[model samples]
Target: MQRDKLITAEVADLLRPWFSDVTVGAQPVIGDAPAVLEQPDHAVTLTWRVGSDDPHDIVIMGPRTQARYHLERPGRDCLQLRFRPGRAADFLGRPLRDLADRAVDAADLGSKSLTAVVQTIADGGALAASQSHAARLRSLAEAIPVAPPTHTDRAALHRRIVAEATALLSIGDGPTHEPVHRVARRLSVSERHLRTVFADRVGLTPSRFVRIDRVRAVLARIQQKLPEVSSRAGYYDQSHMTAEFRNVMGTTPDAFARRRWPTIEACTAGNG
Candidate 1:
């Protein structure tokens, strides 16, 4: 049952602190879909491929620092749960660094709650086209065990610092060009400590996170000229911007401008 609505508000709110988004879709992929430029993400994602006969395709993707070029083929009906930065460890009971840049079978993580949810969805035949998103989410919400309170006072404070620092470094309301050292200073921590905590909780160094965020900001300037984008994205010059763009996105701005690549949604359909 192709669900025409988003995840249920009740379940969404229940998981809002841990997850940034929950999406359900079944986009079709043609013979040769355009490659997708998946930018570095600070959060982890769990993707489930439903709507198939023995539908149990579940993958848990961790935080990524490098750019990836993915080719999509065939069609898919999938539900993705995107965790908020630095929050997956609380729910998954593991350090984010261990899972960085890797996509593993969800079962391998050994989360009983996760396994139960997957089994329930598969047994119930919750195809994206057939089952309502509300019902599917209800199943998930019911199956997910409450996260254990394992964090000590100090550990809890460290997580808070990482979350705050992540917000400052990401492409958000504040000035995106803030240097790592400045961010550390503002957060009342040493730059080295900040880097260490970020690598442990966010799976990326502070400088690398800022670099990826800058590229994302530039890409968001879809209506601006190349020079304007370069300047506004805080690059030293157009040449610098081009180099960063190519390094992070694997394409020059000119080529990207000529042929607008599809969004990540299109590439997410295929298992590749």
Candidate 2:
């Protein structure tokens, strides 16, 4: 697969202060590759990948639960906008699961007009501008109509959930140390409630999120040339790491360290 590049827009600079070092650009995704799921630290993303041969590539919203499939061609590019959990939920107006596992065509998803959304948000007129990209997204959102439950007060709920999740992520190896209960306590909610919220907004539970986070953290450490990647990532031992690797990634850590490491590493290094 070709390395993905960030498609920078004029308005991207506005997001810079928040994302700081993260890269919020676009890259092309080619043919289908293996499925790799990720649990991101900050935002959920709206993603589009176009291939050279096929005009109708996939367009997806990569919530926490969804596995982002790898691209076969290096030339395939993607456009990604990362958002905080609450903002993401508000923007999408629905639980992430509603969009999962379904193959959506680029045309149906309005691929040609995406730049308008970028332009709108960049101009600081996301909610105000009638002709702006943000407005266009709202319009599209209206047409698609995937907004979250009306009674849930999605924005407030998302804020609370994200805060708790972030706090849990701050503690290294959260998943390994009774992750489910720890996260539930941090949120001042029961484990069942936490799972429900996460599933509703992110399409996954807290436990699964922790598992994915752990795998990504270990892989990141290894890429940085850190010694004992497993230990540093809070794995009790190599065996423990291997078990996690199998559970989350469906592969051995060594295989990931050798083959698929760069894609995620690049994503981590470049995510804005």
Q: Looking at model 1, which ten-residue stretch has the lowest summed lDDT?
A: 25-34
Q: Which stretches of candidate 1 lie over 4 Å from their true place?
A: 1-4, 25-33, 52-56, 122-129, 145-150, 173-177, 260-272
Could you tally the backbone clashes for each prediction?
A: 4, 26
Give candidate 2 misplaced runs (Cα > 4 Å): 1-13, 16-43, 49-58, 64-71, 100-154, 170-178, 223-227, 260-272
What are the per-residue Cα lDDT tens digits for candidate 2 across 1-272? 11123323323343432222222233212123243334333245554332112223323444433234343334434444455444444444456555433434333444333334433333443334234343333333333223323445756766567556755654354334446777678667887877777767665566666666677676556454433777667667878888876665555667655555334322321111
Local accuracy by lDDT, each model: 0.68, 0.47
Predicted structure 2: lDDT: 0.47
- In model 1, how many backbone clashes occur? 4
Give TM per candidate: 0.80, 0.58
Lowest-scoring 10 consecutive residues by lDDT in candidate 2? 22-31
Residue 229: error of model 2 in Å? Answer: 1.4
For residue 248, model 2's alpha carbon misses the true position, in angstroms, by 2.9
